[model samples]
Target: MEYRNLGHSGLMISEVTYGNWLTHGELVDREQAVACVRAALDAGVTTFDTADVYAQGAAEELLGAALEGVRRSSLVIASKVCLPTGDGPNDRGLSRKHIMESCEASLRRLRTDYLDLYQAHRFDGTTPLEETLIAFDDLVRQGKVLYLGVSEWTAPQIASALTVIRELGLRSRIVSNQPQYNMLWRVIEPEVVPLCLREGIGQLAFQPLAQGVLTGKYLPGREAPDGSRGKAGGRAPTFIGRVLGRPLLERVQDLIPLAGECGMSAAQLAIAWVLRQPGVSSVVAGATRPEQVTENAAASGRTLDDAVLKRVDEVLGDLVDRDHGKTAQMMAVKPSWTSTTP
Candidate 1:
């Protein structure tokens, strides 16, 4: 696997990070999840990312067990906060109490003393940015977190955060922002990417395959593969529903020949397309099976030429979600028991 420096920091992270999002404790059983993690390690993936709210924290437990014997110094483990994890009013968001408590809880569950990177899952408009940054700075001072990041934050929001940190003379600036980026989801390209590049922040992108829509497995007229995200029920349907349609599927079908010319699978070509961008530090790929892990891992360190990239843009023309406004347009995540969502 290829490794890149995370923003301006001296730390190195694998270009293909293994992230347990919809898999692990939710869609796949413990045994399958464990196998997938092990497969990632075998493929030389040293960076692992998850969130406190994923599977309500079972994702962390499974990851901890899977990496029990590996030397901690050799891996870069990351987790996030800012989502509802319980019913209590203080159990979520970026409030000082919640951030501190959530960090401690994540440490205990991950079987580690400090996180390589701790991210704010989403911007919390309900909480003061000062309170959130102060809490994170406190964690850094206390040696519990090594670096900072945010996910799905807008350009202005991220700039506001930097200004706040500078005004307060905080310990550090954000090193990365995690966004859903793929051939179809170019929401970050217009504004967020430019700001990050100028501010010395890197991007750790997720969903490089558009929730498996670019994998060539979900055909236009055929039923979704038995266990794919298109067929997933419960909270998953809330998100994956956006990419399920004949037009999107037909556009994906057009890219198959491009994959053949590059001597790669459709999924690999899709992932390589994301890696072509310079600001992206890593592509966070989630897999339910060991074979999937192996296949996605190979996409790392591969470069796509200009002609292929131009053809990709031509094929995905109007189907791409380039609207900067759509960056945060998805349904909010909430505690299963809470009446309020964010």
Candidate 2:
């Protein structure tokens, strides 16, 4: 697998990183989880990304168990906070208290002393950026975290944190930003990608297959397959499935033919498309089964020909044009894109 530097940091991560999202704590059992990790490692995937909120921390623990014998220095591990871990009001957000406690908890769960990257899952409007930056800096000083970052942060929010980091002389650098980027969702390109490239921040994308939408698993007219996330319903699953939105569904279905023309699976084309973008250091995809890990890793070194890339742009541009009059600026990086196109 290809490896790239994560921003300007000294650390280098695999082009295709492993993620423990819905698959780890929900879809796969402990044994299957271990197999997935093994498969990824054997395929040269050296990075593993997780969040504290995934399966209420079970994902991290499972990953920890899976990597027991692996050399620590050979891999990069990442996890996130700012998601609710309990029912209480203080259960989430980027308060210093939560950040501190969350890091400790994550360390324990991952069976590691330090994290390669610790990211805030989202912008915490309730907390001062200074407070969050300082707290993160403290973790770096205390040797609990190697680098700090944020997920789903706006351009302004990232800028604000950079200012705070400079002011505080924080040891931890904001090396990476975890955002949802995929063929269907180019939302991050307009602002996030440019900011990251300009500021030298690496983009680690999630949901590159648009939650299997680009896999051609969900057809235009047929019902969603059994055991798919679409069958789950509710907000989170809806966010992943994107099946509830007819417009996005049709657009994703339209791309299957293009994927075929390239002699690649939709999943392969979707992931390769994300890798083609600038400033993307890695794409974090999950695996519920061992075979899936190898399949995704195969897309690592594959590049789309210029013609195919142009075709993809035309398809996306057409959608943007047809959805006109709404001003697709803010919706340019629509969240649904991650679920359908990437």
Candidate 3:
């Protein structure tokens, strides 16, 4: 597998990071989850991504158990905070109490003393930005987190955090930003990419295949290929539903021939496309089966030519979502249980 330094940081991570978001403790059983983790390791994937909120923290516990015998120094494990892990007011958000408690809880669940990278799962509009940044800095100081990152944060939010970091002269800086970036979702390209590039922060892009849409499995007027995430009883309908429109599916069908010309599967081509973007350090790929992990790992070192990329843009046409404002829209919504008075 190919490895790249996370932004300007010296730490290197595999090009394809194995992530257990909707799978693991929720969708897939423990045996299948462990098999997928083993498959990722066999394919030379050393980076693993999970969040504290995934499956109510069972994902992290499963991942930790799966990697029990592996050499810890050889792997880069990343986890996120900020999302509600419980109904309590302090059970979520990026406040000092939440961040500190969450980091400790995550370390316990992951069976690790420290996280290679700890990320804010989302921007906490209710919490003071300085409090959030300071808490992250304290984790680095306490050696509980080695690097800092943010997920689904807008460019302006990142800039403000950086400003506070500079003002406070914090030892830790954001080395990465995890965003849902793919051929279909280009929201980060317009603002987040440029800002991160300038600030020396890399992007750990998730949903590189648009949650399997770019895999060419969900055909137009079809039943989502039975076991796919787009299927009625499959995992993550809320996520996969965004790109399951008939017109979008029809447009995605056009990429099949392009993938054939590239001598890669539709999924591989889609993943390689995300890796081609500037400031992208890696693509976070989730899988329920071992073979899926192996297939995604193959896309790590592959590069697409200029013509193929141009053809992709033409085929996708205006179906892509490139609006930078979408990030703000996402941040505006909060879980019903989360208090607005925070």
- What stretches of model 3 exceed 4 Å from their correct place? 232-235, 328-342
Question: Which parts of model 2 have CA positions greater than 4 angstroms off?
Answer: 232-236, 243-254, 260-263, 320-342
lDDT of 3: 0.88
Rank order (by lDDT, best first): 3, 1, 2
* Cα-based lDDT for every prediction: 0.88, 0.81, 0.88
Query: Candidate 2 lDDT, tens digit per residue, 171-202?
Result: 66798998877775666767777888988899
Residue range 1-342, candidate 3, lDDT tens digits: 999999999999999999999897877889999999999999999999999999899999999999999999999999999999999999999999999988989999999999999999999989998899988988899898999999999999999999999998888899999998888778888899999999999999998987788888876765767656755343486666656677777778889989988888999999999999899999999997899999999998898989999999999877767878786454343222222121
What would the per-residue lDDT of candidate 1 be over residues 98-164, giving only the tens digit for each residue? 9999999999999999999999999999998999999999999999999999999999999999999
Error of 2 at 136 (Å): 0.9
